[model samples]
Target: MIIRELITHRWGNKELVTSPSFGTVEKVFVKDDMRVLEWEPLFIIRTENGSLEQIAVGVNGVINSVHVKEGDHVIPGMVMAFIKDDLLDSDIS
Candidate 1:
């Protein structure tokens, strides 16, 4: 299952998306407190093989954490960010 669905379901598997290999965070498109749509580009990673990969938000939610910043080397299973699923509608808008 995708990250979005897993998060929405309270992470039934608790699995995370990892890089196929080591890479560095090239760019961050989303920030904390931002409302993101499902599958939106959250960041980009540049692999050692010179390939650029776009990491997208798995679910429609607000960004809660940003673990790695630009130019930071990241490994597989690294938590790039946390997305808090907006499961309920609140009147505090």
Candidate 2:
């Protein structure tokens, strides 16, 4: 199944933009050339209200897209990054 889809708005025409997970961005753990497992902690976003939230990988895949950098503010529904799931069946030869 293709899991990579551009995040859009409810109107279908507007592009969905992501902001700090909570209210403020604190740190980013994953970077280029890093291998991560499913449900791994990727980053942390601190909210303006003084709450820290941990962002993790939802699936088993490689980090493909990262829209925000350290100290960048983000919101909900934002496309943090794209993960390409590894195919075990295809690898079997």
Candidate 3:
């Protein structure tokens, strides 16, 4: 699958959030145990082209862990964070 399409994965009550593009993480807006809503901006990345892109968990959840920090270089499909998602298995297609 393409990187952007792999950005989120449903694993029981948890979700994995992955990077969609190659870039440096510019900022992280949440920390472990923080609750977030679907489509909420969780991180901002500065791409190689110097443009910024926002990354989100893509599901409602409490952050379980974060794997990237500001200034870390990320490529497509890199795991950026894990979330304790509220979504059911059927909630994801």
What is the clash count for each candidate, in the order shown? 0, 10, 0
lDDT of 2 by residue, 1-93 (tens): 112223323222222224434455577777654666765777677776777777654455455556778887776666666555554314677
| Candidate that would win on TM-score | 3
TM-score of 3: 0.81
Off by over 4 Å in 1: 1-20, 88-93
Worst 10 residues of 1 by lDDT: 1-10
TM-scores, all candidates, are 0.72, 0.66, 0.81
Backbone clashes in model 3: 0
Candidate 2 regions with alpha-carbon error over 4 angstroms: 1-20, 87-93
* lDDT values, one for every candidate: 0.65, 0.56, 0.80
**What shift in Å separates residue 24 of candidate 2 from its native position after superposition?**
2.2
Residue 85, candidate 3: alpha-carbon lDDT: 69
What lDDT is obtained when candidate 2 is compared to the true structure? 0.56
Q: What is the C-alpha RMSD of each candidate to the true structure, in Å?
A: 5.9, 8.3, 4.9
- TM-score winner between candidates 1 and 3: 3
**Which of the two, 1 or 2, has more lDDT?**
1
